[model samples]
Target: MADRTSKKPPTTRKTSLYRLTDDGDPDLRSLIRPRYLDQEGFRARPVRQGPLRGLLVTGTTAPGPADWCQALADLTGLAVNEENHTAFGLLIVRTEKHIYALGHGMGHLMIEPARIDPGFGIHFAVRCLEKDRVTKVRRQIMDARGRSDENSVTSGEHIRGFGIEEFGEIVSHIAGKVRGIPLTYTGGDAAGAHITGNDRSVKLRLGRTPEDLMNDLLAIEEVCERDDPLPEFDFITQVRPLEAVSDLAQGLDARLDEMLGTGVPGRVGLAVPSECREGFDSAETFRVRVARRTRTVPELDAQTLLGPVSSCAPGERLETLRKGKVQMFADSDAEEVISGNVSAGRWLTAEVVEEGAHYFLWQGKWYEVGAEYLATVKRRVTELLARPSRITLPPWPKGEGEGPYNEKRVAARAGYVLLDKKNVHTARLHGGGWEVCDLLGPDGQLIHIKKAPSGTAPLNHLFAQARMCVETLKYDTGARRKFIAKLDEIAPGHPARDFREPTVVLGILLKEGEPVTADSLFSFAQISLLHTDNVLKGLGARLEVVSIGR
Candidate 1:
């Protein structure tokens, strides 16, 4: 269980920590924008249940497969038939300001807006003025691929003639020789553009959380207001028509294949020369160089750049130092302290990166070789912090989004009465909110629980929420009075915990399993504790961190 009483960022202190989830909506679920998957079959379609379509489907339930069934029906006002080729739908994403959806080059917002069918293709070619005198761009690609004419330069709907991974570099190489077009927008006749590139090799979809979408629009609006007070971009974020989703998908596929390599799915093999300029001949050093040897080395450790991809084959493995002879088995190999002793020619299925050396993913964690060679490892005391392995990420709830909900219920059943929903006050940040103490006991016990699906509570965010809630209550006089009155009615003469008095809350979320994780929570807890002492001390409150099990 991870619990913290950390201080908030400086900005959180000055303004209201809680914003209404919407302009005036009480239900907070409206803030979620789910990710869409691209599995084959019905799941591949961008609409029906996909965020890729850009339709803001309104529903309370975390949008799941079944839930999407009803949402689609509601959106179309007609039956949804995946089998119906003629059955079509369009989904668009837009914020309140862009309710009318206008702006400069709003077309870029959507992956594509035209011909929402499978036949669409993204032609990833340099869009150039015929007079740029750089027809060599196409000619060069054709010559390299041993092609004759422009038609021969492309494959099917894609320009398979050129290396997809080199697209960015190619554009840069010819940037000066060609002019870039402004993608056609009013007040911005952005024309005379150089090479244009879009790929339709793989069905790709882009997703943005509502918060992210809001941030982008807010940033755009801020710039516009500073210059053009009556900015037309207020309508910028609204989803508009462009190309087809299929084209974007293809482009995405072609690009990923280029990066991940067609070798053996997830596993990549590198050969190191026994000779080096410097005397540094360690396998770890050599491996690092190869990974960085590519122009994409800056983005090494592939997973970060790969995005959501197929997991490596089960038991998949990669050997950064495989089939290579070694000087001798040492207590520590390279800069890493080995578990025991590894012999020469023994490939390291699990290795880590360190100070120009591989040292156990920085102390404790370890990543396995194979397809997952590039996975980041977050471990504490040799125990791996788990990632969400669920097929779908559950919808983040609107309330506190904390475990204290379950904790409160368990305690309530165990005889500690908690505040009812109406009496439960929250300080909401329109995006999310947190609850102070779910239930205060007659014994002056204030409880705040954190929910952790992986059995490790996330302390930082929870602490921020808890701090915001308590501070909001403390500063908001009417709210503070109302809470006290409610407490008086709920626990008459029970020595209720008072906001103006030194108070105590049992943070009963952490449970010491067979392997204790409290130490893992140490860093965050220290910061949170310092914050509570400095900030919450005036509120006459302090939280006691403890753990309990079901």
Candidate 2:
């Protein structure tokens, strides 16, 4: 009794796909969680023919109607009682090379975590696109000091662009810290392209039919096999090399264990991950706790939470403690509880080296720096060090004084005018008081000095101050005048009369035995300094970096 006139259902559907990078066929019976499979009317069967020949699964879960249905019915004075059921399906296509997962609704939750490839969608998107326009970009910039900023940008129309400059200047500058957790764009042919991040996976919208899905997978795999599509973004890469090299991966695990035993907050601290943005603004405060019985800590710092870990009882390992869940709870009626890996929350700044390869762990992920990229960064740093000191400043007194007094003493010894605490009011320029520089050289050199830091926060702050000063002086005539006026009052005969473009010297006072070299700085500090130097050069100012041993 089927009606021949009825048209066939649409062949296209929005599909969420994942590629299994591991070898061997996974046991399908054990794949889906038992709770989901135990639901009513769950069916799973094997397919032996056609393009979708693998495993097919379907399930249904009835959780009743949404809570808001009753509220909407009361307000509208109409009957709105309705039952709700979630219908999900999955098709696992096994090919000669690898396995592909096509999921619908909540099908992604069916598979266990071990079989999926991380960063697959991102790598695919970067490879297939041409040199044209990027409409959206999602990026996370972390300062290695536990603070990070995640931003998402979208365009209403396909815009013309290529590389990082496509996001414009300011965004490009901030993106200098890191690039492309996930990137979206419109290709040269003007097709809308996007790649979205999911829980431990990524999503791509593509044709759902078996044939089209197979073809797309092959094309994507071929493209990714080529060389890196974007090399200019090597400043902070997202790809994890440890995934492929088992030896290096093992070494990293051991390194993490040793560092956790030290329990030093400066070397490793904790924070709420930048990616977990749900209900963050509404939470008044966030407290972290490890074990069920351990009292919750007041803040997210490792010093406050872990203290000197040596004080722990025998047979207790911080590494084991790190595996415990970090509960971010707020004191409110909502009582929102968010949990993530304590190890992921820990901010690890030390570099890991194995077999001449370098890696950095920040906010839970490992970022590998290629040998060529490392060399280039070192060369830039060396060039900065080659610039002679503008003034013959003395070595800092061997751990004998604080920053402000030492700055004054150094300036006095070098015949430079100390501008410490000389806060200039340039509401029109920056909307608040900020120092132009710590020391104003008599010959027009702008000197900024800070003691080398155990953490990157102080160095990042120092860099930001120098950058703001350069930008404000370059653009604001009134602010420049105010600075000169303040300068005259501080040192009457100073030669910095008009405040034109001047040489900027960033001096770091190292500990007594630390030498002045490229390796003296942390990787993050070097990265920030390079970006600041580039910005300064673009504004027609020269930059010099020096390390003074105490």
lDDT values, one for every candidate = 0.30, 0.57
Best candidate, TM-score:
2
Off by over 4 Å in 2: 1-14, 23-25, 29-35, 38-43, 60-87, 142-209, 227-254, 262-307, 310-347, 428-432, 475-479, 497-500
**How well is each residue in 110-208 modelled by candidate 1, as lDDT tens digits?**
223222221111111222223223222222110011122222222122223332221101121211112332221111334332232122111111113
Q: What's the CA RMSD for each of the models? A: 27.1, 8.0
User: What's model 2's overall lDDT?
Assistant: 0.57
Task: Please provide the root mean square deviation of candidate 1 (C-alpha atoms, Å).
Answer: 27.1
| TM-scores vs. true structure, each candidate | 0.27, 0.71
lDDT of 2 by residue, 170-278 (tens): 1111111112222122122234445443323445545556675666666556755767755433232333323422344446656755665566634443333443333
Candidate 1 lDDT for residue 166: 19
Shift in Å, residue 281, candidate 2? 22
